[model samples]
Target: MSERLRLYSYWRSSAAYRVRIGLNLKGLSYETVPVHLVRDGGEQHTPQFRAANPQGLVPVLVHGSRTFRQSMAILEYLDETWPSPPLLPGVARERARVRALAQAVACEIHPLNNLRVLQHLENALGLDADARSQWVRHWIGEGFAAIEAMLAEHPSTGRFCEGDTPSLADCCLIPQVYNARRFKLDMAPYPTIERIEAECLALPAFDAARPENQPDAA
Candidate 1:
């Protein structure tokens, strides 16, 4: 807790949202440096941001003088540093399960539907609004369907994605559900996913990490 912490975040960025939830759950205090991803050709693309992260991405965490990029890495870093209320499970197999569930969303689902991809789909490929909507829905449905099976059939599943208490998977999940709803994907198909999302949001940490609650939401 001695070292100062700061997060470079965009309001609606799902990757950033995941880190926000992790920090909140750990009860750590940090500064939020809002980097507007959409204002004036994205502050993230500026030379300054690229200096912090050559990839030009948000959710960069500065712990002391060390800088960390990529949401998954940041989450693990927090969990390892704090070691309280553990973002990951203790058992080896359970930890693997938690990470697998998280990757199912982070790797399989989000990459296909992130902002840059959507923008390229519309602006570069000239997809119409309806086509874009279809694109979002298709990818979400594909991912959610697999996640639904992972949760519903697995005995380890509980109130949250991995267990009753929130874990790394829940951090990845809530934001993706937010995106799914924004794109008007029907929720009826993924009852388990909806139920887990509700449980996670009921906690103050997850609620505060929501897109609308961030200072730079506009």
Candidate 2:
């Protein structure tokens, strides 16, 4: 029996974008429930959405009667369940390396520049547009600098973040790159990242999973 998969996603949300990439890579057909993050005071804050995920975040995956939160967790679940075209490598050491690379973007870089953080900067910190943009750029630059060094110096770096195939790291990295470019961060400083992103985007899965290509993209 095929498990029914449904994804609650926001078009521009990087977290949601990561899940989309994972789903596409696994060749899984899933329904996308567009959760408009910016319309009418944000749909993710609605009572119904809050019940689904108390965190009020996008990329909530409903698999059968089970619900999953967090994009990284969802990716791991899907990979374990499907097991075709695996998202992580076979070796334990390589899996840890891939996870570390993924976390470099997802955990370190993304948290600082997420929508809620930016909203807090505006509503609480009273930062204007320019200052907020600078804040985002600073954090992204700092994280990307470290990631660039990691990728440039590592022997495992190839067409993707780990080896020649796209893994969980690629799924995470591509969305962060998208968000960084949206904030007008210069890509020239990270040639290795740029090369990997180019390779990932060339695939049909990544291209189809882009924010602009989502059903609810505004």
Highest TM-score: which candidate?
Answer: 2
User: What C-alpha lDDT values do all the predictions have?
Assistant: 0.93, 0.95
Backbone clashes, each candidate: 0, 0
| Candidate 1: 10-residue stretch with minimal lDDT | 110-119
Tens digits of per-residue lDDT, candidate 2, 1-218, equal 29899999988999999999999999999999999888899999999999999999989999999999999999999999999899999999999999999999888999999999999999999999999999999999999999999999999899999999899999999999999999999999999999999999999999999999998888
For residue 66, model 2's alpha carbon misses the true position, in angstroms, by 1.0
What digit string (tens of lDDT, one per residue) describes model 1 on residues 130-214? Answer: 9988999999999999999999999989999877889999999999999999999999999999989888999999999999999
